[model samples]
Target: MQFQHPELLYALFLLLIPIFIHLFQLRRFKQVDFTNVAFLKKVTIQTRKSSQLKKWITLLLRLLALACIIIAFAQPFTATKTALNTEKETVLYLDNSYSMQAKGSNGPLLNRSLQDLYNVQLPSEKISWFTNDVTRKNTSLEDFKSELLSVSPSQGQLALSEVLLKANQLFSNAEASDKRLILISDFQQNEAFPEIPDEVTVNAVQLQPVNTNNITIDTAYIASKNGNNMQLKVAVSGSGDVPASVPVSLYKGKTLLAKTAVDLSSEKKNTTVFDIETSGNLKGKLELTDPNLAYDNSLFFSINAPKKIKVLSINEVNSGFLQRLFGQEEFAYTQQTQSNLNYNEIPNQDFIVINGLKDIPASLAVALQSFSKQGGSVLVIPSEKANLSDYNNLLATLGMGRFTEKVSAEKQITQIVFDHPLYENVFEKRVVNFQYPTVNSYYQTNTNATDVLRYEDGNPFIFQKNNTYFLSAPINLENSNFQNSPLIVPTFYNMAQQSLAVPHLYYTIGQQNKFDIAVQLMEDEILKIKDSSSTFIPLQQTKANKVTVTTIEEPATAGTFEIVKDADFIASISYNYNRSESNLQYMDIENWEGANSSASISALFDTIMEANNINSFWKWFVIFALLFLLLELLVLKFFK
Candidate 1:
């Protein structure tokens, strides 16, 4: 035990004053006559004993009261070795992520947390404050309090382990004897906690929100396109009980396009489809009316206007079938024989079809390989009796394996890789017994390529390598029956459409933000992406025939954005918030109680105080002193 003001303990000598007064106050009696001697003797003996006992008891109470008062003034307390003898360093971590927007007792969870910090009486020590996006070190608690009011929640998230590690790093070189790290957060379960080191002590304060139920528009996509009307599919997901009715709205820019209400069942996910009119470069958002979490309630997306697909076919024979397949209005199809093959036009086409080519020239093979490398898709259909060496040379240049001798046996394509993007939404149902394409004679090749179509004998009928696809036999009336099969239309169309590299509906934040477009740009041309309020040039690099644009800075909010080359509008892109913050589940503090080192903020504070063995007992001592003085007063006034 110790005293805060040890010098005041010298007041204990004042107790001697009461003792001396009691000794000096002893009465010197004068003789007096009594009425009856026997009666006087008995009364004197009883009164003397009782009077002496009462006087001694009263003196003892006075001395006890004086000692108690002196001890209270001295500020007595107990000290432990772990108590802070020198200046202490404290680090406080406040979570300001989007998840903190949930409502708590006072207001928003983050706002409540800020108020709690304001109400706390900080110790006289150097303090540091940390959040997900900012860190202020070695600031006074008053300054930190002022800064805390101005802080708002951010989209960025910080893990518990990250906070601890950062605090440890900040205090690693500090000279203070006692160091403490206090974290206050909702403790969302999205990020995993790392093992904290034993050298640093941490105090975790979890803020629990009232409502955890949330409904979010997880994603949206273009289901189908029919002229000016496009069908979009939106996925809605929720936690907790399903809402009875969820109102969904679609917006094109600021204009409301469509609105609908969906009846949700017990299922966690529900897909709703809406058909809306769309024109060129549509920037839109799909919003769900959910009050629990406003951040994920709306999903931003973009849709590019339909554009003509350019296709070029090079053939040795005058095959009318090649022209008929790509001759639709949506395609700008051009056909040229091998004699009139133009190397310059290869870069301008979205897809190049090499149909029944007798031999591939060295210059033409090099140009085609360059086309494939620059994001252009190629479909190679070799002639049955074509020059093997020429085809092999072309294949070798493209890093595709060489074609060996042709197989003269007839084979049927019995299996199709339906899961491939080429066959997406093509057939309503899987055809178990359908007419299969037959190849009379096919080239044998040894290559590490994905087989999209396989023969009954487990041989590859069609194989693809990156953007380049190879067919074992030509699509001719004499060589095979593929031209008459139903698979020919979708197989040729999806290849052309996919080669254009359609813009995605949306992109998630905090990821590699790069988009590949089939449009070519000049050397001095600059690509800029903009929304309704802002515009900036993005980092762009042009490849052989396509341009790649990378977003240098992340947008402040999720919305639809447009890409342009100087004054010409290129495409539309959408961005959405990462869904990781939507999960409100948290790690229970009870789980950490079992661990000797881990504890809650309140528990940790109590432990720190206990370990320091430093507590002011002066309040209790003062109460005791006051009670003793009251007892002494009552005895002097009425006890006699």
Candidate 2:
């Protein structure tokens, strides 16, 4: 037993007041001598004795009542016998990952775990709650209750170590009384569980049944058959002691393509692979037939075949090296004479690499400028035999003008910007080494380009401007020794494929956000706004680069909303990205003692009760005191 407010014991001193009052004598009772002398003596003795007895009875009753009240105010309590006990401020760490949504003994294991938490009854306990995703390091039972009510299943993986570390910090100042941690989860073997703290007593409540079985899709890849083929890898897993066969099926556009059965070892996972030919447009689903764990049993995938890119080049004498660069599948290249330039007939490919356009006609120059403005990439290489004015005009259209500095004969190519995307993964480190031989003075350009492959010269050898980046230094095998190095092929291949291909590919296939729509900003604020109102209402942050708004029940649809706001807009409240409410994975309590781990709900509840125990003791003390006083009075009445 523990007394929360032991200082209240001093209130027993009030009993002294009654004792003093009882001790003080009233005027010596002078018995009237009206009665006979013998009767007078008896009357005197009886009166004195009876009066003394009454005073003693009253003092005893008052003191008993006072003592009971003081003891009650002291707030005494005893600890209940539990498998694990804690007197520290505890935080319950619950897992809310997608995998927790898997079914167990009582339907969804997560739901059953939550029900258990809600049913926990410890009036004298304090509790703080946290999930694998959103955690509150410093929180009270009251605050935890609010968050618990709002907890929803998150789609991300659970980080058990983090929750454990957090739990350790919560009770650092606590004195011992069996500080406890209880984990209530499915206890999946794949989930991480670290060692628990020696000082903290830990227990586990496995939510999963003894023999639950399941099969899941492990991975899916698109492999090229004609262009690209797709491969689907699946694994069957279970908790059963006996081996079982699981059926796996593949579907393409509502049509069943293949079905196969895979045998899984007892308490083990087995993998099976399936291949499909590239149809250029394929949307399909993979299904695994398992009695349990249905969420990961089915997988969806989509594949888009590659399309050919066409380009027109005007290289010097059609160099064999440059011809081979565009010789890959899905690339069609055409070379024309320098005099007969046809811009209208140029195909809409990724880019048009113009080797030397010195004597190009003004009409041709106008056509090239218009092509680039319309989202086309053009690589202009200046040669000693070409016109300069036309090239400068092209540069002017791209927010840059021609160079004013003359190339010095002593100038040499210097540092190269290896960080650029064009050079990324193009060559292995120290695999190939080559140096540029004697180079005739290359023309200088004022174009704001990214100097990717630079020369020893102070000026930029190769640079990029606008949306298009250029590799300016002459790749002519005669001028530079790059051809001798093994990196030449891969370097040119990656640059040609990645540089111009990025813009076109991203614009066509990437997720695009449009700003042209006329979005009505019904009002400037969103906190008190109604759903029926027409407006592009601002929302709070959901993820790294996303925002959302959600409507609740009682007159609205309960769903999430993806919101996009202008950069200038600002607000207070934020949004939540966690969309799934089905997941409720329970963290392992056994190893849940660290700066990151969370204390169990039971532990937190115990702490709160301990604090409230003080007040409860005081209230009980007053009641007991009153009862004792009444008992004393009854005793006196019956004896008298």
lDDT of each: 0.79, 0.54
Q: Give the residue spans of candidate 1 off by over 4 A.
A: 1-94, 117-151, 156-183, 191-202, 241-243, 265-273, 316-331, 386-388, 400-495, 517-520, 543-546, 567-570, 592-640
How do the predictions measure up, each by TM-score? 0.67, 0.57
Candidate 2, which segments miss by more than 4 Å at Cα? 1-20, 29-54, 63-95, 102-108, 117-154, 158-249, 258-280, 286-299, 314-319, 336-338, 345-347, 358-374, 380-466, 483-615, 631-635, 638-640
Best by TM-score: 1
For candidate 2, the TM-score is 0.57
Query: Which residue pairs come into collision in candidate 1?
Result: none
Report the lDDT tens digits of candidate 2 across residue range 460-550: 7666764354434454554455445444565456545542331110011111211111122333423222223423342321311112233
- Root-mean-square deviation of every model: 8.6, 11.2
